[model samples]
Target: MKTLPSQLTPFVRSDAVGALLAETLGHPDAEFTLSALGRLTGVSGPVVHREVTRLVDAAVLQDRMEGRNRLVRANPEHPLYAPMREIIAATYGPVPVLRAAFDGVDGAEHVYIYGSWAARRGGEAGPFPNDVDVLVVGDVPRRTLSAIAGEASDQLAVPVNITRASREDWDAAEPPPFLRTVRSRPFVDVMTGAVHGG
Candidate 1:
């Protein structure tokens, strides 16, 4: 892993770091090395190593050595992973709700509710859960996506982000608004780059 230079920002031990890493692991197939992990967490290599080791010991992350590289992944069953990913995505920018907000009719393709609050907010607030972050991307219509975003917000009973863009936007832009914003943060850049035409 490259030793992060002083010019880089520090990763704070907060929802952003946790959520970004959590979301990165949303797919079991997601893989990365220490340098990648450092960028994802918005932390230096040493900080990431310490946090990852702690998570591994706590059973929140499972670690493997891929040659000289150390790989880390979230334990899928961890109660916090899903919500955390959504929250991290949401914190950086708006995510489309299941509704197609992008369409004139308020229809949407898929919406992922994420973050700590995405895990623990249920009307009766006993605990001060984190914000309800989200990621929305799919074939759903714009209007419909917008309309449903309100309902989804009410259902989650928390701040909901909507990431909605035209297919053309996602296919052509090197860093769509969402991806660029996600990468522009001081502490986290969960998405390293945009998939041109996936």
Candidate 2:
């Protein structure tokens, strides 16, 4: 099968350097250059510059040359960067998981969390082999779902099981989508966050 596209328009998206740049954009800030931002975010310098430019165009950041160095600052209360940062964290930090899921779903749009792993503090237990149960909230493209399930199995070093759930069906429970009891140790860990590992 064809590999999927890398870029995605997620609920929250960030320029790779978004966090590093934000740290310096505020007043009374510490010094940070493109090189510094790259190092901080683990992205390359050129990538940081390009993303910074986009942020500037969106009026989220301001930039100028300050005697042989480019200086950047968050546009005073731009209403964009702050929220952008939050959105990026909520949206992107889970990306390693989400991306794995997305790959499994192969571009299917209707996946959501149902079990303990969905909890903010994580599930009742820590990460475990059986806690990785995932329910596809909508019709996941078979290929994507397969890919994500495989990645989760391999990279997470845990076993993950996939279930199909319609929007109405998945949300019917107290937790909203976990109607079935967990079976595998892998799945149990996923729900409990007991899988304890990436």
Candidate 3:
């Protein structure tokens, strides 16, 4: 998995840990078992278990036994809960939200966030990106992509622009100029697992 930017490294252990924190701590209502979190963040179960143990020891997370499984959630009562949530929100919020937004969208093979926001996340110095640019590669319908983007925009408090391309277009041996440019820039894959170094 790709490592988070340097600025986020002190607070975030790894991309998987950040994703787990973002999903659980960032959203009070969200809860997950170790396996579920692994599935969501694309982290292995052993890794998720280790991270969860650390967070639980630090009082950042609370885990309870439920039948054959352990259900984990953020500890809202922790003194640092609010601030920690804010940090996770600022750094990793878009990912889970985007994942949720496009969860069931048919024919979406890969989803990536490109352009300014992605660049900023990749550690380039600049003013914060105002809007998010999304590239959806698959055979999804434009209207469906638009609707998903609209919902994500409202949820993230940022404008979202979506661009679609077919699998063939995205994987063409000699891709078009736009595809080449997109592939050349920094990007964050929000679906089908993360790819490091854009």
Highest lDDT scorer: 3
- Order candidates by TM-score, high to low: 3, 1, 2
Q: Of the candidates shown, which would achieve the greatest TM-score relative to the real structure?
A: 3
lDDT by residue (1-198, candidate 1, tens digit) is 332221111232543344335434544567667687655344566766776777778676777998899887767778876765554433322222222233343333334443443332111223444344545544665565555667756644555455554555534557576645533332111133111111
- Alpha-carbon lDDT, every model: 0.46, 0.46, 0.78
Write model 2 residue lDDT over 1-198, tens digit each, in one string.
121111211221333433434344422244456665555444556667777788678776777877887777667567665665544333223323543346543334444443444332222333322345566667766666676678667744555566766666545554332444322212212211222211
Mind sharing the TM-score for model 2?
0.36
TM-score comparison, 1 vs 3, better candidate: 3
Given candidate 1, what's the lDDT at residue 161? 53
Residue 189 alpha-carbon offset, candidate 1, angstroms: 6.3
TM-score of 1: 0.40
- After superposition, candidate 3 runs with Cα above 4 Å error: 1-15, 44-47, 119-127
TM per candidate:
0.40, 0.36, 0.78
Model 3 lDDT per residue over 50-119, tens place: 8899999999999999898999999999998988888777666787788778888889898888887777
Positional deviation of 102 in candidate 3, in angstroms? 1.3
